[model samples]
Target chain A: MIYMKRVRLFLVLGLIGLIPIMISGCLGSKTSIQALFTVSPDKQVIPFTANFDGTLSYDEAGRIVSYTWNFGDGTTGQGPVVAHMYKRNGAYKVKLTVIDSRGRTSVSSITVQALNPPPTAQFSYSPKSKLNDKYVVGASEWITFDASKSTDDGTIVSYNWNFGDDTVGTGKIVKHRYIWPGTYNVVLTVTDNNGGKTSYTQQVNILGGPPCNSDISGGDTTINGSQK
Target chain B: MKGLAAVVVLVVLMQVSAIAGGVGLFAGAGPGGAALGEINQAITLYNRLLDNFNHTPTITGNVPPIPKMGSGITYQAGEQFWITDDLALGGKIEYFRTSVATAGEYQSGGKKTPISIALDCSTIGFVLTSGFNFLHYGFTLGVHGGVGYYYSGFTSNITFSVPSGYNKTISVHPHTGKGHYNNRSLGLEVGLSMVYPVTTWLALGVDASYRALTAPRLVDAHGIGLDLDGDGTAEHINLSGISLQVNVSIKLDLFR
Candidate 1:
């Protein structure tokens, strides 16, 4: 009988030990709010905008009233669902805070690896054949445009050129003749393998006529080497 | 170790029966300084590796206490034979040991991973020594030198979660390895001693010695040497040390 009483006392003590856990669980459920969110478009580059959804988050015994987002780059927003765009290359810890009708709040966070920087676009232009004091192109001389110096982590596809002379051409090296002597903005656009594009621009001076004594026409000025 | 004891006993018996002037069994204990160059290097290398690991951009946690191994105690047991009134020869076995350990954990990403590393080592030497005696003012002073056969045992332990250094960050993974690794080498020593013979059959003495012994490399039972530093070359185990001991000697003729 003493052994059985001792067993009963042990069982009573074990039950007493569980009282705190049970009470805490009961108190916790009244204010428990589970905050969950999801983000998509796992791979991104500069200027990437991601969609964050928190509508699936719910409270155990109440309803969520407000959803606040911390975009991790010193920026924030409010909504059950929203879109956030990162202007830089970095890993962002996107956090969300959900508050229930009773003012109970719960927070959830996720880290995202975002943004591959855009490729740098660069090019140098020179007058084909003879040069006058360098960088000085004859009005009708074929200009050699080289974009080979352009670099990127990915391959550079499609080199687009705008001669600013009402004439445009494609290819890494294109030749163009200015119909009249003038200064014009020349732009080179390089598209990378990631389908992202960057452009470089420089002013070109075309010399024609006057005391400079330049006799050249804008016609039949196709460059040698088949324009590559 | 038992075999060594047996060899010493048989040698003692043979000497005692063959015109022995004196035969004595002696034991001593003292502090010893070990020159464990390779083992120390391994410890340093392990710490540097851990520091590099924890320095990674994504890894973080409690950096456990570092591991250490320094000088330790040594015990000696031997039998000596007096070849002449002025010279004595002896055979002995010595054991020396040292080590330290630590345990902790590190967290990477969402997982908390336990981490630990421990190191310990020991060496047993079988040596034959010869001492010359000269009496001055009733105190005997002698110079001694000996050759020894040494065996060294080393152990390494490393524990941590894998799938780490996710980007080929840590070059050398200091992993848990064989519980024991061992190798053997020859040793040589030279020292000085002073003794006072009491009653013509008993004596007390003090000896100071310096030993040079290197096991070259230690390997597990499968003959695999460890390159804990990832230096591509196996570590060199140096057992060299210096020690001072006080001993007692009882002449065998008293028993005869």
Candidate 2:
């Protein structure tokens, strides 16, 4: 009788030990569903002046999550905020999807565009090398022209009006066209590839004739010079 | 008695004739000188060989096997003799305390018992050996070998503790157990001792040897003990095993 009673008591204790485990297993399945996924910047289109801040979030009880960013390029990307590069211009798309613990899913997306930038511009001027010396009114002189050495590394090549006078033009050279002349300043204006422009002016004196003359006799030979 | 006497006289006469014959074999002065030179050469060769043998250390080949079954270590004491000039010899005796640790585990039908024993053995021995110190190049070496009787034994006290207490403790009385279980063993000993003389007579010498024990193995009889303290107990006995003796001696060379 004692042996039988001991066996029964041992079985009862074993069963008592298993009760809490079964109860906890049943309660574990009823937790609330949660969503999980992310948004890189949280907000939409990022401005060049402004940076984009993105984030990722997921429902605690959710599963089967994915990300797709439209970047507005008609191209699509998947997997988180993943990657983004903004160099020149245009809008980008940012998307996020989260599945809840119950297998339900939700998606969020935003567009980001890059700002446009201004074009750069620069200018340079050149003068005719052929006529480098002073000119005189009603007087004519001949000189060689060279403009090959002048250059602007970044500016665009453009031409404007050339004022014909004793003033030398700083623009690409043409044949000299001076009629009445005096000490006159020469001016040149050039626009660069980006539309930036600058002008330069310089002065040269024009005289009608030589200022003095002299007669010389040597070895029975005579030479004569004249001045205006 | 008369026949025996005749035999002895004949032997003596024969020996005398042999000696005379030897002397006459090279009697001419010229021949005698040559023979004398040859004798001298032979003597030199013998002396050189003797010196070489004496200068070299010797070792022994056979060692007696003695089982030391106790917690205390066992050791050996020994001696080597090198007889050369004027008879010289060296002796040494050593005591070694053996390691005293033993363990055994046995299991029987789901029951196990582990047993352990330990002993610490330390050894100390000394050598007082000498021999004919042959002089060569300001150094001396001796050639010696002799026969001697050797004996050794051991003792140990053991107490058994029974933790189970069926019998908690047992007291063992000391006893004088084995008497020279193997009495005196005749051993042939050979040794060579080389001495680098730091002085005319005082020299630092080392000897090596080969010794062979002829009969009655001593180490085999060590299991008996003695009750020297008279507490009526005896533990272990007669455990001297084959021992190799190598010794260095400070020699007082008889003749410079």
Candidate 3:
């Protein structure tokens, strides 16, 4: 039994001696093939193009035969230098793998961040059409305001309007009219989900359309094109 | 601002009456350098917006480089009254302006946005000066110090874009019209000058002045501070800077 234990210890020592040789063979030489790359503008807003260059990679024992890229967005490419545009916003881990002529491969990775852009503000108003380059609307008439023309990459949380007459309203589509006949500045302010705010202002002229009996319009006046 | 300047003029004019000897009119202009204070804080505001995505911002396309406020131009017009041949007292109105206009891009990891910005600042000072003219042969060497009221104006047309999560672009403040911010503060200045004798009535002079001025508060027409860094407090304005100017002075021996 003691002789068998000595034999087992000898085998363990031999295994330890062989481990380094196996690792050395796998590790290659001091100038072993390395997959090194650089990414320009790795961080950007969505719909952004990034440039990747793997020319800095080197293989001392053999020529590098292949350069493969995994953009982490479920896309792949093959080249020494390539440009990729991120269509969506997210964190992407880009990988570059270089294979030498000897079939040895090395991999490097970098994290790319694509950010979201802000929403643009736009809107169109009806019964407030342009006449001779002027926005004209009849006073005390139904003027429909629409913000559907406004766009956002995400969701627009709120649409606020300042009717320039100390009256305010909210929604994607609203109706407002001036009480007195004059030129009024209509302002539409939109807020996106990201808390970004944008405003659009249009100067609209309100016509009295000759003298209207003020006695008949009293208390029955429709300032917002709605009967009070 | 005008009210305070008028009061200061009365106080200085009384002092001039006490020691009237001779009078000289001077007008000068030159390059200047100053601190931008809240005006530059707009860039910090821009960076903070970009940093929201947890990505480092790489800004490209700016003049004078970012974070380095800028250089400016100064014009001064004033009159000095000689209390004696070597001693004189003066009052001058000086104006200084600096401008910055940039259309650039901010890039983070893989995304980018465009930005267009314009900012111009002006400072007007009404000051009282005391000078000791030491030399008067080929060149006149003198040193002077002054105290005054400085009115600062900041005009901004700053516009920066951000991305909506939905793949659209929007302006942070589309209603951010051209806003003019104004502030006023008391100022202290000291300067040295050397004048070359061009003629009996005209002398060409070069002046180097250091002004120390700070406005504790700056506000817009709506009484709102131009707080760009998300900080509720408005950034103070610093008009302190060095100005080197070339001047032409007409000296007359009056009531001598």
Candidate 4:
């Protein structure tokens, strides 16, 4: 009975020692391979086409690994020798994360820009259509002006009309009445959505009642005279 | 996912280590009667220090009501009393100053004249506290009770200037009034904390306490500067409400 009890105690101690060894061996098989974090040249710009080359290896023990790249443009890609192209222009922080066989990971970050050409604006006014050659002063008349013939690559948001009489309005079509007989310069100014503007002017004349007819009578002789 | 998993693993490891360390250290040290007596003595000393805080004379007040209350700051203060080794009760006195000036709205007067209203209130209160040490694990739990008398005063003044065409200074009682009444009210307090021993006689603790005060109805009669429809007094006045107290106290162990 004494021998059996001693054997039992020895078995318990032996099992206790073996448990840690077994766990250590199982964990050792995982082999912590520290990730290789790298970026080529450390800098570049967008339209950004760059080659990514990072080789992850083992710490004396061989382990397979994977790489993930965050372009920081709300986009992510993966591979070892990854090729990337940035579409927009701005400074972007790029991140590279590597994971080893045991699911351990390491990350690196770099800032780069997307190079792009400066934006341009181009514009031209619509061809002007004639409204009548002459109209009496103080007479109201319909003057149809077409402002849609204008074109701008950027975008045209508004049109301002200077009716030549110091009266101005905004829109494609406007009706104007001249209260005085005078030669006035009518200007149509159109502006693009980008704030780029171009103006065109037209000469308009207001005739004063056929040169003001008058009648003259001297003793029995009557003559009709008109002031031009 | 990887970062998150790493964090989770670290936290699990830290928790396991803390539990293991605690059990190991306690078992190895084993309990000695003399050591237990020393701990008891320390607790007694801590409670005695707490008892030294005998009377909580308190003063608290709110800014004048309405527009003034929104723009002004409220202040409160309390005095503490030590009732027992594990309990400390005190009374508090508080004062509040809130002022409203019509200077901005009535830059030029017709009906638009300068008026200033300031409502001040004060309270004297009582408080109760209970404390206990947490088995060397460095934690304390406590409950609090408080009661007080609240007083309020609402003062409104109007200074009007005659129109440019007329030469006269008109003084009228717009709403310059005083409301003085005393009401007995009760307040409840609660707090929880963790205490860490810095030395044999010194300790550091972090605690958050809250006090809620309920009082009688006090009218806040200050509002719109002009009585547009030709009414003698301006309208749209309301009553004042209850207040809450929150404090983070850094305590010093004044004695062993």
User: Using TM-score as the measure, which candidate wins?
Assistant: 1
Candidate 1 C-alpha lDDT tens digits along A8-36: 46545644554453333223111236566
Best by lDDT: 3
> Candidate 4 regions off by >4 Å?
A1-228, B1-102, B105-112, B128-141, B150-210, B217-256
Question: What TM-score does each of the candidates earn?
Answer: 0.47, 0.23, 0.46, 0.24
DockQ of each: 0.01, 0.00, 0.01, 0.01
Which lDDT tens digits does candidate 4 get at residues B1-256? 6597468546644553443211100000111111111112222222221222111112111112233231222334443322223334333444433343322222222343332333333433343333322235444444333333344333434332222322211111123333333344443333343455555333444443333343433334332332211124322212122223333233333321
Ranking under TM-score, best-scoring first? 1, 3, 4, 2
Clashes of each: 0, 78, 20, 28
Report the poorest 10 consecutive residues by lDDT, candidate 4 chain A: A218-227
Candidate 2: regions farther than 4 A off? A1-228, B1-101, B107-110, B114-138, B154-182, B214-248, B253-256
Interface RMSD for every prediction, one decimal?
24.2, 48.1, 25.5, 33.1
User: What TM value does chain A in model 4 reach?
Assistant: 0.35
Candidate 3 displacement at residue B203 in angstroms? 0.6
Model 3 agreement with the true structure over B1-81: per-residue lDDT tens digits: 779868877876677667677788999999997765444544544543434323423343322233445488999999998
- 3 against 4, candidate with superior lDDT: 3
lDDT of 2 by residue, A125-217 (tens): 223222445333332322122232334435435433233352333334333323333554544455545444555444434445432331211
Q: How high is the TM-score of chain A in each model?
A: 0.49, 0.32, 0.50, 0.35
> How does residue B164 of candidate 1 score in lDDT?
44
Residues forming the 10-long window of minimal summed lDDT in candidate 1 chain A: A22-31
